[model samples]
Target: MLQKMSSVQPFQFEPEHEISEDENIEDVQYQINQNEDDRKVYEVRVGQNGWCLCGYCLPMLTGKESVCCKELQFFAVAVPDIPCITAHTSFEAVCLNRDVLWAALVSLHDRESADLSYRYASYRQFTWWMHVIRIRNIYSEPDGIYAGFEDVDIDYTEIDQAWRDW
Candidate 1:
């Protein structure tokens, strides 16, 4: 009789320090900002133990036709804070509110580049999504919609015509 070998290893998880319990929200935000400022590239330590299951991993394990493969047990770390917006099986996409996304963009723009940095496409995609969400009022209720920074500007066409005449 031939014996089947299973290569699946025990899942190991490393617990991350909770960021929300800190006394001041500003302090926590500052720490997040500082961490972003100090690092060049963010590392996603998948399958290293304590990291959360990204959208891809979650559905693969729990979906109707779950596979019993060892490779499926591994985890991955992609760009930190850029939610997995791409998994096909997921029912809903994670949406960050406009203010939060804008703040993140502003912070990213203001920070000096570290050795590790997010890919240009990823940053652009997130910013574009945030802009779309702001225009659509995806986060707020019917009467409580928030206006984005761009709404404050006057139309450039009038200025262009005046400058042309001058």
Candidate 2:
């Protein structure tokens, strides 16, 4: 199992922390400067411990990963063409409910090669962790009434679990 898990390549990206808590959704999108044509729509899904679309979340959902199986109370979506979005709540609750959505943009900075350095080690860098990005407005699910991010539930959990699943 360890070997199999190790075989998967983790998605690469950077975090966008420019969003201010007081900023409106439209401003947030403008700050990112992502064009609609370049933007991609990623369906939400449930992974192992929390709802996430990382290497761990993808394999564990298919019974391929078993080391840390736990209740699913989180959500995440990562696409090569768009920013990664995720949300989570406490596992002790009777039902999962998330009120916040965090976004991480793809990395635009990279070094030419890995070179050891005490002060400048090559590493994955994120400007911020779990930064909140506002949603413009509530959008309806495929077969349901209009709903906000906080209202997203099990209905959206299985949309794209097979993405990069091994």
Candidate 3:
């Protein structure tokens, strides 16, 4: 596992005018460069937090917006040793932060729960480490359900673990 993101180098890139075969990918549910014959790509309009919600317009962009969801080139980033992030949007920087990646690979157990989002970078997270991570009050543990907007990340254990792992 990567000890720590040591450095972050954000660069701007767009899907090739004709995307290369290797560039096409399907991971974590987002598809890239499909229908090679069709030149058009899905237009991911910006919602409140800059993530695209599936078609029907959300009256107000409220939902758990995934920063690394393959389709965006925009999002924030946290760099090495330095406790900060920079969003290099427009085609490459998906909601990727150094701490989140570090924790998932180097610290987080395979089953450890976490909620990595741009929200962590917000001012609200200044006191975020005080809370404890717990199953949402809504569900019983081990239900195999993914937590969404249920205040799962209020606890900063995941973040703490990331730094420890680093």
Candidate 1 Cα outliers beyond 4 Å, as residue runs: 1-15, 18-88, 91-110, 114-130, 133-137, 147-166
Q: Kindly indicate the candidate among 1 and 3 with the higher TM-score.
A: 1
lDDT of 1 at 47: 27
User: TM-score of every model?
Assistant: 0.19, 0.14, 0.16
Q: Per-residue lDDT for 97-142 in model 3, tens only?
A: 5654554343223333344334343323543343324323323467
Q: Candidate 1 or 3, higher lDDT?
A: 1
Least lDDT summed over 10 consecutive residues: which range in candidate 3?
82-91
Residue clash pairs of candidate 1 = 12-49, 13-49, 13-50, 14-49, 14-50, 40-114, 40-116, 40-117, 41-116, 44-77
Q: Pick the lDDT winner.
A: 1
Per-residue accuracy of model 2 over 72-148 as CA lDDT, tens digit each: 22222222332222222222121222321111121222335444222122222222222222111222255755332
Q: Where is model 2 poorest over a 10-residue stretch in terms of lDDT?
A: 99-108
Screening candidate 3 with a backbone cut-off below 3 angstroms (N, C-alpha, C), the clashing residue pairs are 67-95, 73-91, 73-92, 74-89, 77-85
lDDT value for model 3: 0.35
Ranking by lDDT: 1, 3, 2
lDDT by residue for model 1 over 1-166, one digit each (tens)?
4222232111122234566554688888888888775442223332232233443433222222232222232223222333443432221211234754565455445324552245544564676776766535534567766554332123453334444443
Best by TM-score: 1
User: With candidate 1 superimposed using the best TM-score fit, by how many Å does residue 16's alpha carbon deviate from the native?
Assistant: 4.0
For model 3 the local lDDT of residue 1 reads 32
